[model samples]
Target: MGEGGKRKSRQEEVPAPPSHRILTADELGLLKVSEVPAGDKWEETAAKQRWGLPDKAQGITRLQVHCPDWDPDRCLVAAARSSGRVTLHAGSDGGDVGSFRAAPPASTSGRSDTSTNAVQALRFSQPEGSTQLLISAATLGGHVSVHRCPVEAALATAAAGRAVHTWEEAARLQTISDLQAMDVSSSGRYLAVGGDGHQLKVWDLEVAGKAAMASTTSSAGPDGAAAAAPKAGEPLFAGKAGKPSRSGLQDLAHVTALAFVPGQDDKQVLVGTAKHKLWLYDMRAGRKPQAELVWGEGRITTLQPVADGSRIWVGNGRGHVEALDLRQAPAKLSMGHALKGVAGSIRALALHPSEPLIASVSLDRHLRVHHSTKRSSLAKLYLKQALTGVAWLPPLPAAAAAEGAKEDEEEQARAEAEEVDAAEEEEQQDAGRVARGKGKHSGRDQQAGGGSRGQHGKKKDSKRRKQ
Candidate 1:
């Protein structure tokens, strides 16, 4: 009851009640699936739509940004629909930015691949020392398209026309079947693409960057370097996600998820397959997978490396999360702790860069975000559609992050200082006890000497009496 309590505002006096919005079954039924209508009456339009269920979320990405105008709590999510279209959604109330169709290229093999419009995967990559955001999308057809989007321009266009940049490929990495999983190296030096046809392709970034740079100089576009065929550098090497762990070497299965090990020069990768087996594929260590992590259960839907590559967060089709430590042997990888998830198969999982928060999506049409270390649920958003993929934005800056948490460095320093003081106090106490023990022993010795002298005097007195 100090100055803060005496204030008339009473803002901090009473804990603010949790604010919630109530939506009827009807209101919850329809959310705007299309563009923001003219005059922008859609906040009501979404509430009034007839269709109860919404379009499925097949793919999603968050446009990375660091600015003062943007709200730190709000996130921008772009969801790809089954209709071969991509929509930029700004949170629950953040109106749709815009939508654009991702057209597939005409097949060169004569047979037509019309499934190109169905975007199977969506990801954003920003190479080191670059400001432009590169969005890569892979469709059901063997097509991967990279779009160079500027944050200001994309959002401006999205606000003005309710549509963002028209996606044009900066570099094309064609696969045999629909690409299932793709990851760019931390350094943006390599790109790994895995697909349904058991095809694994790695693209060298230096060569691709030069190619992208040349193309940009000629046409002015942003690009992601490490994810495709050898247009300029290393030739595309093919491998498999197949074969038993003990059966020597064979091809690979349909790769469902991918993760690049984190390091300045970490070359190893963790590949999750339809067979529920995790493979450590190291290109530098020969063609065979470096190790295989198998548990013999659900298909791996998403993978996230944490604890600086020593730990990995694995989500399966069964809607469960497994925390696996890969530093152990492959057999030990099966020993993992489980985290509760959605009721259905998990489609994607995105771990926070600095925090223990992990955002995940499920076929159950919900975004379940949980704390990795605390074994607790954080937020659950029932996205109206069945979600297929999810991406979390990069970690916030130190100053912005401070709002959500106290400075860990300060805490660590205080703890260390307390430990040192405690140790010093303990040593001082031991020395004091030793000194007291010596003093007691000296007193006992003096008492013993006095007793001997008294005995001698008593004997002399008895002799004098006898005389």
Candidate 2:
């Protein structure tokens, strides 16, 4: 607005771009589901489809999807209702995947009248690279269950694996009240679990058993050397989530999600919270978030690190999706929104491994595709159904390009690091004013800006210029 109409006219004189075309049904690529029978329910009006039913269901608390690979067709979807029952479906395209009843032990359920226990979250882990293991965390019982995909399928083979076989894993270190969110690294090496209690737990199983997944964070012995193998059944490390606290939610805001940078030796984990905050913890560096990504907003529900680990995609409750490139210094930090003014909370987002496109879903029943080539709208999908999750298909086999991938990642990391450093430098100067006692608390108050909270939370590129 400050630049005014003079700037607008100057821009208009350049050229008027053509209006964007909204693809017709025939023109848009088909969204096909081979496993489940196709139905119009997802694209129907309220009278035809049960819109808002899931949100209205007081008994249901959380929804989770379990896809072994990147393929959406060969996946399993599960929703945990407050009624203590978990419904699992094979696909939107054919047969029922399986429905399993998960409840407190028989001895425990007799003590309570609640029919459905609120399940907080669920995640899939593929440690040791065998079959996928599904895990569930619930509120009241503080229980976690692990089920192997093939094992569950074999058991259901008699019934088509439509029968869920849930096995109780070792009791989780923390209860639901302590839990905030959970994530399994892409390689299935470590399970990062964080909660309102301010601690992030890194469960390492590289030496736990025959199905151990190698950890990239693991290093050779002393002074840049290799270390010995861990005991056969013990975890390499149960790295803490955050500093310990007496009370979980009261002491710390609940954690919402955790994401690890893909294809990196450093175990850098991105953690998001309900307070619209993001922090980065380098497992190789410290137990707590050493760096933070700050951009003022309301509560954040989702955090996804781009493949390179230098950039992060975040979604907040107010329907804002932003890409925080972490390379710039604190003094010169810049932010760009992929989409703004969305209808509902941006709850789920999926990033393409190789492309600049990002797919985001909102509870308001919208799905949008954003292009990373600046704040441009590549396409928007108006689904008749509210979207709960979205996973972009990975690049096809024929699309493999190793050299291109390496170059892209390096460039992205360098750019993000520069931005983060610039922002950090500016914040440091602000912090300096207070340290000199000129104004004791003015700089601290400036932290309300969000991204300025931590100066060195991100890296910096060598060429970043100072003002």
Candidate 3:
């Protein structure tokens, strides 16, 4: 083939660049519901049927994303329902992958039970240099169970009404009652739980694992057979109560949210309480909180920290979301502006993995996205059910990922071009200054020479006149 034909072939081989821009907070404000892609919106009824959930199944209570850094290809989102069931979804498309019951069914034998065994929290952990994924689920009944399964097996297709794998329960904790919050450290070594009992507890999973193994080996029978051993373990660190009030009564400091500070090696934690208090505790420094801050009047509901642990976004029960800078001596609101558009109590808050966007679900049944910098409402969608949790699915789809890459390339190119232009402009300005300086010096020299020559001529003429 000739050169022109070969060039044409090469051009055809290259895929066309996507005709879309990276989604921004400003653009989100102008977006309409109809303009939203069909795949982006979740149809409640259709989703129920697709997931084989009963028509009257409870709404989603919690959402957790499992995106391990070791394996970027493995991204999964788990949504726990109020009915004690947790359903896994493909992080790329929000498609239902599998479901499992996290809590046992409630008794129906005329028991005057006021509280349901709904899942209060869910966390996903994959230890470093490990192939298995651990899912920690905490129910209101005080049972915190950690289940383990291979990543591939958990994501594999299973028969309808069955889990992808028979995930083995690796550990269990029945210490805290009415558990309202729970978190697993990034290292997968510590598990924290807190609730109405006004106590914060942390468990060392490494110790628990060793204890479980030792118990299993010791319990072996004469035939060298041993049954599955109980993995329940006590908390390695338990926080104590605060000082008494002026009325000589202890405060009802209900623990609502817990988060491990990043970069602290899972040794420091930030706890949110129902009494409008935020406490920072260092596990190595004893049981008392090292620092505390009071923000608004509402009960604290959620806490999300930046990657470096410099700041945290705190959500309260009065529909307020504020970012507090931890670097401050007494951690104060950093954003200056609070996230708006949430009309009811915020149920959950999720930070975007790559964007400066904050996703929040409220009791008003709306999912709102706000700009992290501007703290302005970007987009808002109304779902029919009472919104409980919201999370950003990671490992975006191929088309979206490619589009994002193109946007990043374009942005980088623009930035480089701007820098070059700025440097050239600065150089030109310096050249003009040098040229002007030379001209000024030449003019001064000419003036001086003319004055000297004129003075000499006048002196000679005066001498000649005298002669």
Among all candidates shown, the one with the greatest TM-score: 3
Lowest lDDT 10-residue stretch of candidate 3? 25-34
Candidate 2, residue 93: the lDDT equals 26
**Which of 2 and 3 is ahead in lDDT?**
3
TM-score of each: 0.59, 0.54, 0.66
Q: List the residue pairs that clash in candidate 3.
A: none
Instruction: Rank candidates by lDDT, best first.
Output: 3, 1, 2
lDDT per residue as tens, model 1, 1-467: 78866786653333321111111111122332221122322232221112224423333322222222333234345555555665655432335555555545444557764555566666656676775656666666645556666655453522334543454445654444667777767665567778776656677755655664565355532564333232333434555554554657554468888877775264677788887888777677666676776754888888878847778888887777877787763445554666654557876666655567676767777666666787667556565654555544322343433431243346667989999999999999999999999999999999999999999999999999999
49-129: candidate 2 lDDT, tens digit per residue: 111233434344455545445333355555555555555544322134555545444443257645424555555555555
In candidate 1, how many Å is residue 75 off?
Answer: 5.3
Question: Which parts of model 3 have CA positions greater than 4 angstroms off?
Answer: 1-54, 68-73, 93-96, 104-116, 152-163, 209-231, 243-249, 328-337, 394-467
Stretches of model 2 off by over 4 angstroms after superposition = 1-73, 82-85, 92-94, 101-103, 106-116, 131-141, 151-178, 187-189, 205-253, 326-337, 352-356, 378-387, 392-467
For candidate 2, give the lDDT of residue 15: 23
